[model samples]
Target chain A: MMVMTQENLTSKERFDKIFEVEFLPQIDALYTFAYHLTYNEDDANDLVQETYLKAYRFIEKYIEGTNAKAWLFKILKNAFINQYRKKSKAPTKVDYEEIINFHDEENDTNYSTHTDLREEMFQSMMGDEVTNAINALPVDFRVVILLCDIEGFTYEEISKIIDVPIGTVRSRLHRARNMLKGQLKTYAESLGFKDKRSKD
Target chain B: DYQELVRKVTMYLDNELSEAEAYLKVLSQEKSFREFIKSKLHRRKPSPALIKSIKDKIKT
Candidate 1:
């Protein structure tokens, strides 16, 4: 059997190993998330670098074999809020519209009898505008939508990440989706969405 | 009723629905909204330079 020389690995070597194995893989995801949060390539790069720096600094506290991605994400998110958010001009929040008003505007819930193929056609139309709509949101609302809709995190996972109660996550998600629907309403209508049910 | 439908839209997209038919119905009712959210499902990774930069910056 080969000798297991544990002491041969220096602290920097060990740190490099963990960083390469654990942290490096999450760079793209962290950058993508950073991009969505900051809405600027340069800011995203800065945010991601800051996150990696922090993660490296506190690498000793990180537990191996756990969810490294989530841990990195938590650090990135905190870094985004603590660093990027404070420098941005948008106020942290707006008044919560107790009722989601988008659906209330045109509730002609008369289901369109469009074929699956036609539905697919409409789905194909929903590309770039969705990205624009997502980016247009205030940072706080945008984060929830990105975490839930884009990243596919569950409400509980998001609650844990954002350090909010699950109920808050739910409400925030609800509001964010409503806001997106409102922003995309015009674009959606132009694609033969509104009043198409009347024809069908 | 539309708010109820909106909730269904969120649940359906979230894969929380038990029945596929129910999800399709939710999609059918909130057609535009469903399509919009589904479109956000695609992936986007960072550039190679960003990855290299992270690697470079992490060194002591």
Candidate 2:
């Protein structure tokens, strides 16, 4: 819990109120979302710190009694898209099949007991395959999938968040799910599941 | 025809399609479509560490 310095605050009373009310409960969740997007602990911390600083600077613009989580995510997502994604091209163009195949090959020798292997497979997943699959999708589909499936946002909320029609949200979600199913099918086959058919 | 069927079955699985539409789809569709949707609905959860990492990032 980092405290806001009085010198950094414009007014002592106002800073006290903001610190007491807005800053405490929301910081953890905000940081977690940032971390997930950045995929780096240090970067996530910096993003959260930056987000709070920006939010604090423009606190007057934020409407009270509205959904704070949505607002925060919007800011974070925008920051990620505009600032981070643009600056870094390293993570943007990953080849999913190659990565998965490489990883599978490297870990092949470690397979021992059935129970241990299952547990290891589960532990190794780390959502990398799913994230890679989603990232490989078109931007519209990726955004809709992340908001709806990964973040558990509703269609109406996503409509507001992405500034798209509800119908568009539904259509994109459908496409995204289909794409994910296709990717998962490949992953399953690689893992020796035998079945390569779409389940949905 | 297969693509159209797939799209309809997808909507039905998501419960987005109307009852009448779903009824038509399910009745006319191949058995494999239903099996597909059933398996898809049972998606595995992402690893706990991944969830925790995301949660931790948001918290920071």
Which candidate has the highest TM-score of all? 1
TM-score of chain A of 1: 0.69
Largest lDDT belongs to which candidate? Answer: 1
Cα shift from native, residue B52, model 2 (Å): 18
What is the model-wide C-alpha lDDT for candidate 2?
A: 0.59
Query: Candidate 2 regions off by >4 Å?
Result: A1-24, A88-128, A138-140, A189-200, B1-60
Which candidate's DockQ is highest? 1
Q: Lowest summed-lDDT stretch of 10 residues in model 1 chain B? A: B20-29
Write model 1 residue lDDT over A1-200, tens digit each, in one string.
85646664576688778888988888877887888786667788888888888889998888876778888888889988887546676676644552445345335454344345557865665556877788778777888888876677877778888899977887788888778878877877787666232211
Give lDDT: candidate 2, residue B24: 54
- Write candidate 1's Cα lDDT for B1-60 as tens digits: 357666756666676556852545556756556555666645557777877777776653
**lDDT (Cα, tens digit) per residue for candidate 2, span A1-200:** 86878655556556446544765456555564565465556566667666655665666666665776677767766766776556666556777997997677667775456558767766765555655565478766766655554456677787887777888888787677667667866665565544423435
Predicted complex 1: CAPRI docking category? acceptable
